[model samples]
Target: MGRKKIELKKIECPKEKSSKYSKRKKGLLKKAEEMAVLCDSDIILLVFSPTSKPNLFYPHSRPLGRILERLSNMSEYEREERRSYTKKV
Candidate 1:
């Protein structure tokens, strides 16, 4: 069976909101790891918690510093062009 669909609305209860966020964050991290592995693609995912703590994920085989350096060397236009190319593919 496919995954259940969650309603796209704010959870009104603070307890529920915190619980849901914890669950979803872990799920997202797992998916990011899988995508990096199965696709043999570079991925950099950075998420900030409600309290502003950062969580970073990238393939352990490739260093995050190298990816950041490569990304920094690209111009703004180049970044957008690459995004469009990937979207099309």
Candidate 2:
């Protein structure tokens, strides 16, 4: 069950923003854990709050740095390919 849709803009009230952040953060982490358990796969979730605080979760027994590096390299390669294709066209 999800909450009703709301605008993405910042909440003016500090208390309300804090409450919302806590709830959503917990919900996301729970979902991540559930997916990892159900699929038997590696899952890394990194979230940054408005205050720049980071929350990291690793469901599998893998190093966080290694996974981030691999994902970064993959995205870079894809970006380069896309650039080359656009230049040729």
Clash totals, every prediction: 0, 0
**Candidate 1: lDDT of 7?**
72
Quote the positional error of residue 14 for candidate 2 in Å: 1.4
Which candidate leads in lDDT?
Answer: 1
Screening candidate 1 with a backbone cut-off below 3 angstroms (N, C-alpha, C), the clashing residue pairs are: none
Model 1, 45-71: lDDT tens digits are 999876578988888999989999989
User: How does model 2 fare in lDDT?
Assistant: 0.83
In order of appearance, the predictions have TM-scores of 0.78, 0.60
Query: What RMSD, rounded to one decimal, does every model reach?
Result: 2.5, 5.9
| Reference-based lDDT, residue 2, model 2 | 95
Off by over 4 Å in 2: 1-9, 69-75, 78-89
Tell me how candidate 1 scores on lDDT: 0.89
Candidate 2 structure quality by residue, lDDT tens digits, 1-89: 99999768868887888889999999999998898888866779889986789988987556778767766777777979978999999
Candidate 1 deviant stretches above 4 angstroms: 1-4, 83-89
